[model samples]
Structures are given as C-alpha cells and as structure tokens.
Target: MKPLNWFRLVFSFIAVTAVCGFYLPGLAPVNFCEEDKITSDCQLHIRSRSLLQNEIQLFVNRLDSVESVLPYEYDVFDFCKDEKEKRSSENLGQVLFGERIETSPYKFKFRKDESCKKVCTKTYDTSNKKENVRLDFLKRGVELNYQHHWIVDNMPVTWCYAVEDGQNYCNPGFPIGCFVTFDGRSKDACVISSGFNKKNTYYLFNHVDITITYHSEESESWRGARLVSARLEPKSIKHNSQENSQSCDGPPMDIPKETTGILNVTYSYSVKFEEDAQEESGWKQVHGDVFRAPQSGMLLSVFLGQGTQIFIMTFITLSNRGALMTCAVVLWVLLGTPAGYVSARMYKSFGGEKWKTNVLLTALLCPGIVFADFFLMNLILWVEGSSAAVPFPTLVALLALWFGISVPLTFVGAYAGFKKTAIEVPVRTNQIPRQIPLQSFFTRPVPGIIMGGILPFGCIFIQLFFILNSIWSHQMYYMFGFLFLVFIILLITCSEATILLCYFHLCAEDYHWWWRSFLTSGFTAVYLFIYAIHYFFSKLQIQGAASTILYFGYTMIMVLIFFLFTGTIGFFACFWFVNKIYSVVKVD
Candidate 1:
C-alpha cells in the first residue's frame, strides 16, 4: 500500500541476497587437489601425509591451584626441567594473565610411538635444607591440587577422564598430584583411583600417556601433516629401580607427609598417534578500508585501549574473588601501559597528529571517570557512617598507584607506539569521499546499533544474573569455566550481529559505519543498565537512599567498563569484516 514500505522490503531482500551470494563461494568446500576441480558442489578433500621427521614439543605453562588466586612458574615446583629451556613469546594479555609458557622435558617424534619413555629423575634428599624446603613446597603444591597446563602445537594438552555418573569430562589442566590425609581421606586427583589409599602421603603424577591426533594432507606440494588435538592421561607410578626400569609400572609414587629419608620422582611418558577424520576450517577476510580512519578517531582509539584493559582485568579476576577489589585495582593500574600502547598505535595509524593528547586521554579518561564515581560513592558511605567506606590511606595508595606507576608506564608505552611506523593498509583510500545514499529506517545508524546489541545481550543475560548475584547478594562465584564459555559466546554473538548489520549498512552505501560499528555492539551496555534497574527493583531488597545511590553508582562503573569492552569487540569485528569484503570485491 505504501511506496516507502515497498522500497524498504525490496532493498532489504536485495542486500541479503547479494551478501549471501558474495560469501557463499568462500564458505563452500573446495577441492585442494586441483583448481579446475573446484565446483559449487565440490567435496572437500584434504590430502595429508605422515611426517618423516617431525619433532613434537610440549610446553609447560604457569601452575595455579584452585585454592589460591596467585599462579607460579613451572620452575617453582622444582619438577624435572628441560636442559636447554626456552620460553615462548607471550603477548601483553598473556603476560598480564600470568602465563609463563616454556619448553618442557617432554619431546616426541611424529608417528614414532614410544612406551614408558623416561624424561628425567628428581631426587630430594632430606639431609640438605634446600632440598627439604623444595620437597615441602612440592608437597604443598600436591596438597593444594595445583594444576599443570601443558601446551602442544599451540593447543592445550587436555586431560580426559571419566567423572561422576559415568560421563567423561575433559580438563584443560591436570593436577601436580593428589594428597591423602592422616585420617586416610583422599583429595582431588586421589579420588580418580582407588590405589591412592595410602594415609598421610602425597602421590606425584610422574607418568603420562600422551595421545596426539593429526590431520594428514596428501598434497604433492606439502609433505607434512598438522596436529589437530593432543590429549594426555596423568598417572603416579613408582619404579623399583630407575636404572633397571624399562616400563612405568609397579605402584603409585607416594611420599610420606613427613619424610626423614630421600625421595625420588622419575618423570616418564608414553606417546601414541591417531588419524583425525575431519579437518578444521576458518573464514578468511580482506583488509584495507576497515583500517581507514574514522571520525573522532583519536577518542575512539583511546576508548578501545581502555576497553581492552577492562576486558582483560574482568576476565582474569573472574576466577577468584578473595582479593577481588584489590587485585582488580592493581591489575588495572599495571595494565595501563598496554592500554596506552594500543591507543597510541591505533591513533597513529589513523593519522592523528597530537600524540600527547591521545596518550593522556588513554591513561586518564576512563580511569578518571571511574575514580570520580567511586569517590562520590565513598562520600555517601562516609556520610552514612557505613563501614564499607574506603579509608583516606587507601585513596592515597590508589592515587600513588595511578600517578606514580600507571601514568609513567602509560607514557612509556605511548612513546614506544608513536616511535613505530604506522600500520600499512591493504588498499589505498581516495582523498575525496563517496556520497552515501538515502537510508531506510532499518538501515539508519541508531536503529541498526540498537538492534546490534540485542543478540549479544540475549547470549549473556542468564550469566549476568549470576554475576549480579555474586556482586550484590555476596554469593560466591567460582564457575569461571562456564563464565568463560558464556563470554566467548557473547563475543561471537556481538561480532556476528555487528557484522551482519554492518553489511546491511554497507549494502545501503552508508560508508559511515565506523562509530556505528562500535556503538552497535556497545549498546549492549544500555540493555545491561536497564536490566540492572529492573534487578534493583525486582530482585534486590534495599531500603535507604544512600544504599540505592551506592548500588547504582557501582553498577554505573561496571556498565561503562562493559560498554567499552563490548564496543571494542564489535568495532574490531566489523572493522575486520569491512576490510575483508572490500579487499576481496573488485572495485573500479
């Protein structure tokens, strides 16, 4: 009946069709054998070959116990060390998260199976004080059920075993050992086997059964295959004589709680291979236009960096809350350098001239906002004579951490970033801009941004309930694994939704998708804020204005951080998608 409505429907249909058609070819399975063999209905044929000389290296990451928030390097446990140890290069995020991945003693050749191969032997003599101390620390690690994270080919070497109800569970990390109490009660990994019944003893996982699954590609050009998955089964085995033992068998390696004599732990492993039937695939994108500087590029870059810092802080702090407030503040303060670096790099790439302003904004903008809000909240607490009020000394310490440490580090990072050359774009931009076409209601910026966040919010709303409960109701939140999975899902949802809407905007010839992209996913924070208001009234039972002010004030801080985090995710995703499409498509 209406011409505008009719036009909208036709335009939407055309855009969807064009996008699908453009992406469909890349999504389809292609024959690796020959370019001529590639067809619409071509079957994906991965031709893999067994490597003749493949060296599989196992890397040991930082050790962490469920009982403690702190993590330590592998060397702290005094386990068998690699003679020529080398550490893998870690990113800023990994370093901040306390990941210390280094070469381990475990090494194997591809396709060549080994059974009960001895790695190294560790002898702890009680006569030596240092040895005794090391032994005690090892025992403490066992008692606390400290986990060992092993990496193979950049993938986690999972420990898969049967759990309760006969269902199998795969743990990304395995415990250093198990502990048996004086009363004969077993803890952690001790429950996995009935053999760990020895009283007042520590059982060390000195042996491992490693299974590596690889995908073979049988191409004339390439000869070697790639590892798809790696799994290991840890065991505590005792050898009657280290010199005489050929196979890892006899009994569990148990150490007395209070040992007066010498103790030995012989680290060993067995390796096997399995051919993986399926091959993993990834979507490819182009780059160029997406990297093009947007309007208010400097401010956006600063926000992006701050957002990334908040994301890292939130992710790492979620596992334990014993020292949450203090740890989070410390992490945020320490993380300023990375934030400044990211902001300066992006701003520089965007052709920003005022480096000083960009760095200052990056270091101060978001943190200042949070501190100001917190100070206001603290004032309310002080006026109400609440015990929750932060002491003046604590404020001074925070200021010291901010100005004395964070500010200086941020400047250093900014300097480093500015010194580097700007990132090269895949395609060059024209000095003159193209005129954008008239947009319909659906294609408009605000409506599209509003719609972009709904899916991501939908993905995390249930998890948000638990988080809110942990914050307000003082409920213990320890389901970090599930929370992490939900976080990943939220990111995916945000990226896909933002990309889809971005495509729609691009199809409509609306080139101004930069801020829109960030805001599109960032709008999830608005929904989160709305949900908090609903939760405040419906779920929480509060009576005072000060209490309400405190609740909303703290919640606002969370919402702002979340806004930055989700917005950064969406912005980067859409940026990548736009770059990919533009680079791939033929343009005049």
Candidate 2:
C-alpha cells in the first residue's frame, strides 16, 4: 500500500474507535432493575405494604385539535386530583418527545365494589364573569371534538366498543364529549348515541367509574401488589342538585344550551384486588378479530424491500468490515426478489400490459435517481479536492454493483413475478366509472395532496432536526430506539393520513385514487426538502459552492428514499382501505 493509503487506514481506525466509544453504551444492554429489585427507571414495581394499599393514577389529555395542535392535560380543566403528588421524572428522550407523566386527581386504591366515589367537583357559576370565562374555554375545547388520552401505570387506558362487524374495537383514547351544532352537524362522538342529537347543546362527561385491578405476590421478597390494569367508563349525566354525586348510572350529563346556570361536574373512580391468574376475559372475547394483517400487499413489499436493504447496510457496517456502498449493493441485489415479486404482482393487478417497463423501472428508476444525485455531489467534492469525494475506482465498483449484481437479481425477481398470477381484488371494478363533480380549490386533488403531508411531517420534523444535526453539524446520533419509534410513527401517520384524504376524495366521487394516495403521503418529503433548505440557510454555516452543492445533493438522496418509503406506506394503506370498503358495499 502507498504511504498515504497507510495513513488513511490508521486515521479511519481512530475515527471509528471514537464513534464506537461515544455510542457503544447506547447500543449496549441496560438493566433497569440494578439492585435485584426493579427501580423507578423500570417504570413499574411493587413495594410491600403493611396495610393493603394500591393506588393507580388516571390521567387524561385533550386530543388533536386545530386550535393549538397540542393536547392539554386534564388537570388544566381543574376537576381534581391531589396537587401534592410529585410528577414522574422524564428521561431525555421522553422530554424531547413532549410526553407528560404526571399524577392526576382521578386515582383509585384497592376497595370493595366502589361505584362512584367522587374525587372532586368543579362548580362553574355562570353568573360570575371569571368563572364563565373558564367554562367557555373548556366548552371551546369540547366543541372541537377534543378527546381524552387516559393513561394508567404507563399504559393507555383503552375504550372498548363494538364496531360494524360485531367485533369490539379497543381505542387508546376517547373523546371528551362533543357539541351538537344548531345547524345539525353531529360531531364524531355525538353520532354514537341518539341522546347526543339534541340541537345546540354541549354534553360534557361529568362522571367516571374507574376500575383498577391489582395482584399480590406471596413471596416474602416482594410485599406490595402489582397493578394489572386500570379501566374507566366516561358518562355524561344530567343530575339536579338533589342527586349530587349520588348515582353514576343515571342518564347522561346534559349541559343545557343556556350556559348561565351553575354547572357542577363530578369526577370519580374505584379500585380492587384480584389474583394474577384472574385476568379479564372481556378483551379476549374477540380473539378472531385480533388477527388481521395490514392492507396494501404490494406497497408493503416495496417498503420492506428498501428497508431490508437499509437494515442490512447498517448491520454490516456495525458488525463486519467492508465498504458501506458494497454492502448496500449486495443487500439491494438480494432484495430484488421481493421488489420484483411485489411490483410484478401489483402491476398485473393494475391491469398493466408492459411487464418489461415495470421491471426496468423498479430496478433502475430510484437507483438511477440516487446515483445521479450522488455523482453530481461527488463531482463537486472532486472539484473542491474534498476527502468526501468517491474515487474513480469506487464509482466503477458502484456501477458494477448496479449493473452486474443488482440488475441481474432484479431481473430474476421480475421474471418470477411475471410467472405468477395477478393478485385478486376482493371487489370487482365497475364497467363504468362514476362521474366526479368539479371540486372547489380547497377540496381539489392538489390542495388535498399538499395538506395530507403536513401532519406526518409534523410528527417527524422534531426528530428530523437531530438527524440533520448528525449529518450536517457532525453530531453523533445514537438514539436508534427513538429513531425506530419515529419511523413507526411516520409509517402509521403516513398511512392513516393518506387513507383519510383518500376517503374524502372517494366520497366526493373521485376514483383516481391510485396515484393520489402515493403522492399525498410522498409529498411529506417535499416538506422535508423545504425544511432542509431552511436548516441550511438558518441553522448551518457551510461555506463554498462545492459544500453547498454536496449538502443539497446528499439531501436529495435522503429525500428520495423518504419519499418512496412514505409514499409506499400511503399507497398500500389506501389500497387496502379502498378494497376493504368497496368489497363490503353492494355495487351495481
């Protein structure tokens, strides 16, 4: 080896060592219970008590609203839990994620068949101007269909209700009542019951029956009881002053149209002890309903195909010694099977005639885009004499990977895909397409597609800041768990948001959903690119045209990958949703 090559090798060793030293701890296994006993870090443990005592915390938060875009804690409503309880100390990641772990007034300890033990009552005097102001603010949140995200023992308190299939759906959160507009706009929660159909009235849930179950271990080493789970049922009741806190089972609470009278809302809960073996069987009644796969088979295949390649690259980079580009090529070439299978099946299902074009596009289109961007960035690096530039030999190797290995593997996969029959849709397509009306500007496809990305972007923009810092500012990012979680959230958000917008468009009689679904979620990458530009100008101080070009070039590669990933999610989700919905409905 040349002298400069030897020096470069040594420098690379030193750099890798420094990176490992900083991040190895984060990757290493950790014991949340260090002293043979579970610590607070474990977030759950039971300490022995002389007298039987088990207190479970119930917390509520307002759900997603356009007003603030952030949920407010139920304690903000001032309906009452002990104020002296110390709030849980959050980890750095939790704090950054904006998680709130605090005690609420709705707490319950082990007791006999307790129905509605009033925790506290909030009396808002309509006559008092200050009291009325508080009441109005609370009403406004309810009017927006704000929900309650209740948590107990660090687990979401689920709301179990039956759906159309006679199967019960357990939602992580429930609405905090809803308003019935005078114009007959029945809000989401209002539609669940006819009692809520009363015009021009706001129904607030003023009572709760909480059930906290605990299990006691006989082992002398452990004295306290472990909480199994906590459940609550929110009820809206209209009780007169004579019936104050007397019955929780009474009729739903109706806050009259007139907000001038004194409004008293009572909150309460109960707790009990149970054997560990005595698990609640209600949640298990719908075992048949529990096993369901996510929709959009083809889209998932594309995503998994790309994800497998990325995962393989990360794994090899950490566990073995080889150039990153080489590993990516090898993994990607191997992943061609899935890619071809998915694409071929999807294309066939779409009634596409050109198999060769589908296969070629799948194998080359995205890679070509990435390579073009990378080559441009490399040229800038070469011009500036930057060490980051890829050498000519490496470029040749990359081409070998793409043409020699990746292309062949992709062809093999595509060949298999072409041999297989097209995937069958549950619903048959109609011979005549429905005519779509002229959509307004706001409801147009372009506007909806643009707006669809904002939410998924919002979910990830905070995490993106750190990722950008890692890449551009030369900061170490070791939060793989957080990153993985963000990835899942992004996937879910992208799918759901796309599905929602797709549904609205379909309801508007627009059948052009295939591309719309993909673009809607994919547009989030555009927002990401925009943010990168903002970050480059405002947050970064990169000097010189070469560096600027390189920054944007690499950013484009990332944006492209993200675009495909998010777009795949939306497409598949919407695809599955449309199939499912269309299959269930009778079509002429």
Candidate 3:
C-alpha cells in the first residue's frame, strides 16, 4: 500500500473503533411493567434518573391539519392557555419545521389521582361579531380536522386505539374535534364515536382521560420516579357547569352549522397512574485511542451538513411536485444555520485551523454548485420559451434570500460553533502509522465500495420509481408515511452494509477505510443517475434538447444530494462501529 493509503486506513480504523466502544453499551433495552403491577420479575436494573418535583406539567405543541400543510400554534384556535405562558426554547431544525411548544394549563402531582377535574370554560356568543369570528375559526378548525400534540415528560401523549385486523395503532396526536357533513358523512375523529351523527354539526372534544405511567427508582440517590409513558383518550361531553364538575358524562358537545345562541365548551380531564418495573442490563468497553480525522475533513464536514439539510427537507416535504419544490427551497434556505453549525463543529473537532474558510465553504460551496446548474437549466428554458422557466424577479429574490438570510445565519452558526469546545475522543492517535497487509480482491477499495451501495440501492429503487414519476410524470405522490419508512430502511441498510464492508477491510489489514466508507454508500447515487437515464429512455417520451438537458440537470442535483446524504450516513455508521470494536479490544 502507498504511504497515503496506509495513513488513511489507520485513521479510519481508529475512528471507527473509538465510536463503537463509547456508544454501544448505551443501547440497552428498557423494561417496564403493565397496569400498576410490579412483580419480582419486573424489578430489574434501571438507568440513571434525576430527582423530579412532585408536580408534573403537560406542554402543548403546534396543531396541524391533514387537509393542509401549514401548522398553527396551540393558542391560535382560542384554546385555554397557561396564565403565565412560557415557551420552550427551539432549535434551528424545530423552528424551521414549524414546531411551537408552550406550557399548558394542565398540571399534576406525582402519584395523585384526580377525577372529573374542571380545567376551564370557554363560551362563544354568536351575538357578538368578534365572538362569532372566533367561533367560526374554531368550527373551521374542526372541519379541517386539526390535531393537538401534547407533551408530557418529553414524550408525546399518544392516543392508542384499535385499528383493522385486530391491531392497535398509536397516534402521537389527537384531533381537536370532528365534523359531520350535511350529507351525513363523518370526517376524521367523528368516526370514533357513533353519537357524533348530527348532520351539519361539529362536535368538540372538551374532555380527556389522561393516564400517566411512571417507574419507581428505589435507589437512595433519587427521591422521585421517572415517567415511563403518557396516554390520553379524547371525548366530547356536554356539561352545564361553568365551575368544578363532579361527573364528566353527558351528550356530545354539538354545534349546528348556523348557530344563533351562545356555544359553551367545558374542558375537563381525569388523571390516573400506573407503576412500571425497571430493569438494568450491562455491556462493557474500554476507551483508548481517538479516531483519526480523514483527509479534507473541512470539505467532508460541509458535504455532510448540506446532505443532512437536504435529507431532512426531503423527509418533511414528500408530496406533489409544486408543493415539494416550493417547500424544498424555503426549507433549504431556513436550514442554512444547521448546515453551518454541523460543518463548523465537525471541522473544528477534526482539528482544522481555517475557521473562516470552513464557514464560507459550508454556506456557499454546495449551494453555489446547485444554483449554477439550475441557472443553466433556466437559460435553456428561457431560450426555448418554456413556461417552466422561473421569472427573473423571482430568481433575484432567491439570490437575495440566499445572501441576505442564509449567508448571515451561516456566519452566526459558525461563530457559535467555533466558540464551543471541540469534541473529545476517548482514545489517542498512535505516533507511528500501522502497516497494512496485502488485501484480497473483494476487500480492495473500489470493489468493496461498489458492492457496498448495491444493497442500499436495491432497498430504494422501487420507491425511486414513484419519486421519479412524481417529479417528471406529473403524478400526485402523497405516500409520505411509506416514503419516510423507506428512507429509514435505506439509512439502516446503508449503515449495516458500510459497517460490514469496513470490518472486512479492517480484517484484511487495510485501514484506508475513511473515504471508502463514504464512497461505499455514496455510490448508490450513481445507480440512481443511471436509472434516471434508463427511465427517460424507456418510460418518458420527450423530444427536444432543451427538455432533455433540463431533466438531466435537475436529476444531477438530486443525485448529488443523495450522494452526500447516503455517504454521510455510511461514514458515521462505520466510524461508530470502528470506535466500538477498538474500544473493547485490549491493546498492550
């Protein structure tokens, strides 16, 4: 092996081993008991716990409707709010994804059960114009089937119910209300209960049965228990009281399509607890050496960040072409801070000195390449007089957003990252590079990398067909749930395949696995590009140089993003695996 290859391989091996050793032991499964019953079998080891206050607070998150892509804050629908409203701090990703989490009025004492507790009473008088508007807004929210996402102990308060085939499905959110159409058709949550059958009416879910489960920590170190799970069942119950109510049973809270009188909504909840058993399992590893940073660590980190941004954007907006394109651009622009932060953090951890260059490249390099390609495609569209061409003013606005918003945000994020401490590796690097033994054909760099992508490509090629159709064939693709599942599967497959290949290379006494790990999964994009060509010739019927150029141009952008995304996934996975294995191995 060449001197450079020897260095690369040794660095890759060290990095992978370090990560594996540090994190693998933390992946143990948690055990919990059912229905307040804690048998001796259930009393097992538990993870560390912090002392909790007697009071448990429930937080409210944004409300989103399936009928629309937009999400609104919890208070927007005139719902009850905390007297001293406090919002949780949001990360860049959470903010860009439109998550608004705030403190709610619901509070509970640990292990204390309450029944038929009145939260608040909301009255909408149709006589007043402002009240009418608020009522109308609430009714519209019901018509659109907006869902409420409540958070307890950092866990979503799920609504688990039976589905088809005797299976149970748990939804992380619950609908605010349900609407019965004038034609007697039920929508969304209306199907949950048979009482919501009044035609041209809305039924509000004003009552909830909340169940909070916690595991007791018997350790003398901690005083309180940790919450294991939180679940709720929403109901629409008509109540006459404006104050505390003893019983929460009545007819459904229904509003006619056109109401003339005051509409009363009484919110109440019942709370109970279940004790869960805790278990502890143990695995061990020793930390010795730090993973070696690969060559061009700055560029690699930038690519990783960009790829992560694209991956997240794609995951969120897997819909029709128009919405997809619009959302992708906006999301990509808003996500610049994350990209810069990730790139700067990784680059600094790799011991790179050129912070200014790293920040600039993180903000500009990949985006510049994409804009250049798009500009070429737009020129073709303009010359051909195609309606698909973006307007000049729109292009100018895009440039302004890129420079004015994204660039500055990137600078801010990079500055913050530079101010933080670099990531510490448990192991130290060897003074002298280890020599690599002769490699077999299968373990060689090119062959191993090529083989690495095939499994991941196979996992997504079928879904790729639908994605391509959504883009080029003008088909409506709304299977986001399944698409997300496939994306997860692709991640797992890429990680497993890369780890397997990296292990093979390491066993063969070759350490130049750094670039190999990235390219191994990254090569999947090559197959995607080839498939695009085959798809064009075999499936599509377009005849024009401009059109062909436009298709291939956009396809190249997708391919590049995919290359980065998959490569990042593989690289990190291999890095973790190497660190883990090496951490446990006893070295003299």
Would you list the C-alpha lDDT of every candidate in the order shown? 0.82, 0.67, 0.81
Candidate 1 lDDT at 59 equals: 96
For candidate 2, what is the lDDT?
0.67
Cα error, candidate 2, residue 517 (Å): 0.6
* lDDT (10s digit) by residue, model 1, range 1-588: 654356458769977986776433213322122233433332222323122234677899999988988899999999889999999878799999999999998887767789998888889999999999999999999988899999987689999999789999999999999999999999988998999999999999989999988755552133345677899999999975647656676799989998988887788899998877653111212122334478899999999889888878877676444587788988888888788888888899899999999999998888899999999999999999989999999999999999999998889888988888987555676666655557799999889988988999999999899989998999988777678668768878999999999888776766677799999999999999999999999999999888999999999998999999999999888878766655543221
Q: Give the Cα-based TM-score of candidate 2 against the true structure.
A: 0.48
Q: How do the predictions measure up, each by TM-score?
A: 0.52, 0.48, 0.51
Candidate 2 residue-wise lDDT, 492-538, digit = tens? 79989999988777656566676788889989999999999999999
The residue ranges of model 3 lying beyond 4 angstroms of the native Cα positions read 1-290, 319-322, 586-588
Rank order (by lDDT, best first): 1, 3, 2
Q: Residue 225, candidate 1: how far off, in angstroms?
A: 29
Q: Candidate 2: misplaced stretches above 4 Å?
A: 1-329, 586-588
Q: Point to the candidate with the largest lDDT.
A: 1
Per-residue error at 356 for model 1, in Å?
0.2
**Which window of 10 residues has the lowest lDDT sum in candidate 1?**
279-288
**Higher-lDDT candidate of 1 and 3:** 1
Model 3 scores worst on lDDT over the 10 consecutive residues at 280-289
